[model samples]
Target: MCGIVGLLVKEPELRESLGALVVPMLLGMSDRGPDSAGLAVFTELLENCNSTGVVPSITRKYSLYIGQHQIDWTEFTHNLQQIGNAIIKENGNHAIVVSDCEPNLLKQWIKQHYPQLHILSTGQTIDLYKDAGNPAEIIDRYQFGLLTGTHLVGHTRMATESAVTPAHAHPFTAGEDFCLVHNGALSNPYSIRRQLEPQGIQFETDNDTEAACRFLEWRMREGDDLETALQTGFEALDGFYTFLIGTKDKLALVRDAFACKPAIVAETDDYVAISSEFRSLAHLPNIKHARIYEPAPEEIHVWMV
Candidate 1:
């Protein structure tokens, strides 16, 4: 009922083509998911903000969603100066804010002021954009074709369970440099939320995918590696799911024991591509020569940037 796409480029030169290559892959999945779509791209760290208008010596970034709301980004940046150096690069209904302030400090400020602005992801390398709309229109609005990154995770949702709001979209995130998109449902999201809420972990949306995303992220924050966190996920998460995960340097995928959802992986010397179905992956370069396979139930696959 959903479409998930991930691309990790191994050859350095292919990095610049990341967006151009992934756009077609995303467009091909328009039928599988027509409600909402999202994309998160991970790039190399850039210490200096170039062409962002307001330059700052930034150490981290927050990909924010304003939806259809309009804001004076210049004045907002001026106001944020009290906390620390802050700058923004606005892109149709979304913006990437680079800041020197702590995550909590900047988050609290935004929540207090522009409550409508939603934090999509927080990190130095990850820039995310997502919203509820026609998949193709959403892609065009966010300018997905211009993205440049080492890897990315994307999703298109059909919204069988929850409301079709931007907040309910997939590619849920927790902590820094981490995000997850799911292709199936979880039966015990409430139980999982109860387990993590006591440990001070927060939930942004009631989406079942968010529960799984935060749970794995919490495990990693507690000292488990990506693979270890996913093993823990296999035990903790209950439901049918094909999860495509993205981190600062890793792209991982896993399925529940049932493998109720569909997932296919295409790998080549230049990049690794994954999607819910092959039609979405047909446009990749030399795709006919790539080694392709369907993941086994509960199998874990991880690709490094």
Candidate 2:
């Protein structure tokens, strides 16, 4: 079994308050998985606006702000290349970097394509930390409380079938943008692995969670949105699982058809929190009256800022 927790803070300042909320909850779950622990925190920011009528200052650095403008990374890069010097860097679904361009031009491009995406925080906003160890040890070593952001998802793992190593730790990351932690098994991982191997998808560890990641990546390549890809996974994949997945923009919680594992989710005006056990949210300062619910069998719950 594994432990999973998530928090979505509407206000940036509330992120600082989440550390105290998460510490006890993670500790309460130590018995579920003692081999490893991990957390993914996401935030958004706006760069300083400039008078040049160039790209908005907020759109200059981190792509999360630009994402709010809904500019397609691929299309934006193509546009950038046509007019001026630009470089792009991508890590899974989380990031896109464009350098040496006019901020106003970038903003205009984003406004044209993606007007619905919102910018909530900025600058080095998302963080992923994981290691092979117990929750307390990992938190202490990582100083988890110091990490402030708009949202976070955390996990603790106890390897049953997989080897005990950092490579197999929860919050298994693909590039710098997406990570996932899971409880339970995938019935047909080998078949999936065989199919993925030839397509240049590498497997660093034999854990089924890694296979799930690859599966998601494949669906994304096939033109599926994150939620659609995961929903399709419920039909195409056979398994028993409860997954806590994190990307630069969202947190997804899913359970298999049987709902063989356990998970709990709670939401408040200021934040939304989820975990494998109830105790995880016991200490939240704003939780005067907390309602806990479980995901329906074969259900997927996604939270975004």
Candidate 3:
């Protein structure tokens, strides 16, 4: 069993409270998933402005995690001087390095030099934090209470099919600016992986959910829009799953045709909240005024920011 939570704030004024609102929804699922927790938050995009209101070198962020490894971050930043316009903001063991330089080059540099540094995500608006531990503790360790974002996808995992480690945590990301949290298992993950591995898709884990995440991202990379990619996912991915996906500007939810896994959605004029169960969403602001419903099997529900 696992818990999947997603929140998308439609009102700009309410975006600052994104993390504060999602933490409760996540805590409510602690019993369902006590092994690990993760969250991917999408904040405002970074961009440089000229008199024309646009600049060609839009910013990109790389969320980095140093797990039980000691590295001089000062030297790291000093080294980053070569990659012009790179800036870093740190919070404990996690740091987000923002830059307008080539993200691919930065990622390769970190991997080649600081192999222990795990690149959690890379995109203009996404910042990812996930690890192996109690959900509540993970939340506090990362100061989830203070995160500001347009939307977020969160998860608590009770590892069934893989080792309990940060690398296997949910909110699994493949390509830039996208993440997926799964509440159910995928039966054909190996088959999917077999198809993607040869396509140059390198997987970071053996977790079944990674296969689904990569497959969907790959479809989009191959020119499929979100809706079309999801439709293709319906055909290629097999098993019972309630998926909560977060992109740069959208939060999407879907269930398997059987709809064996549980999911609930509560939408109000100000925001849309989703969880594995209603209990996970009971504490949201104006929750009683929200229009609540259970998503139908095979239905893809997407809400744009």
Candidate 4:
């Protein structure tokens, strides 16, 4: 089993505390998943930077990987300068690399040259972080509490079906402003991957959750809205799952007809939150009086902020 937590803030004043608020929720679900954890934070790119901080461009955002080897930052930025003015932010084992280059060309350059360094997610608003560690440790190391963002979706993986590594972690993102965290295993991901590959879809890890993330992305690319794409998933994805999808302005929760997985949703005038269990939501602001309920199977709940 894995744990998934998502927060969509309705009140802008709460954005600065997004990470601080979500950490307790993630740590509370440690029993469900202790292998690896990740979070996707969506916010406007920062225009200013201090000496020891990240410099984000207003036009672009990138999620970059450093791997086990270190690269010369001065040399790397110099090379990147040829394509566009690049800004770099280092966080634990990864970096958020932003440039003014068009996203499509930037992606091409990354795939063709820096094949070893993975791009976790690329968008003007989304920054993704994943690592092999407990949720509390990962959060502390990343200093997520200092982050200000519109929303965040986090996951702690149990790793029942894949290797315990950063790549296999949840909250997998394959498209701009899109990411997903799942709580169950798929029955036919290999077959499903085969079908998606021919459509120009790419996958980094063999994790079933990655397949689900890409599938939803592909469907949305084919002109389906979030609700419609998930409806297609209900008929197409073969598994028992509870999926929490985060996009630039939307957060959605859906479960299989079998409803074999657990999910809880809490909503109030100030925010909308979801997690695998009720305890995860206990620490949220004014949560005690929120409208809390378990979503019925096959029922898709979409909240826009």
Candidate 2 residue-wise lDDT, 1-305, digit = tens: 88888877766678777766677777888789888887766646523333454654334343432221334656766766654444444432234354444655654555575555322112234455566777798888666676666677788888877887655777665533566778888888888899889988877679888888778868877789889989988986788888887777788889888889888888777778888877777787667675668888877788887
TM-score-based ranking: 1, 3, 4, 2
User: What tens digits encode model 1's per-residue C-alpha lDDT throughout 233-252?
Assistant: 99999998999999999999
Backbone clash total, candidate 1? 0
Two-way lDDT contest, 1 vs 2, winner? 1
**Candidate 2 residue spans exceeding 4 A from truth:** 45-125
The residue-by-residue lDDT of candidate 3 on 133-208, one tens digit each, is 9999999999998989899999999998899999899889988999999998999999999999999999999999
**TM-score of each prediction:** 0.96, 0.73, 0.96, 0.94
Q: Is candidate 2 or candidate 3 better by lDDT?
A: 3
List, in order, the clash count of every candidate structure. 0, 13, 0, 0
Against the true structure, what is every candidate's RMSD?
2.3, 9.8, 2.2, 3.1
lDDT of 3 at 8: 95
How many residue pairs of model 3 clash at the backbone? Answer: 0
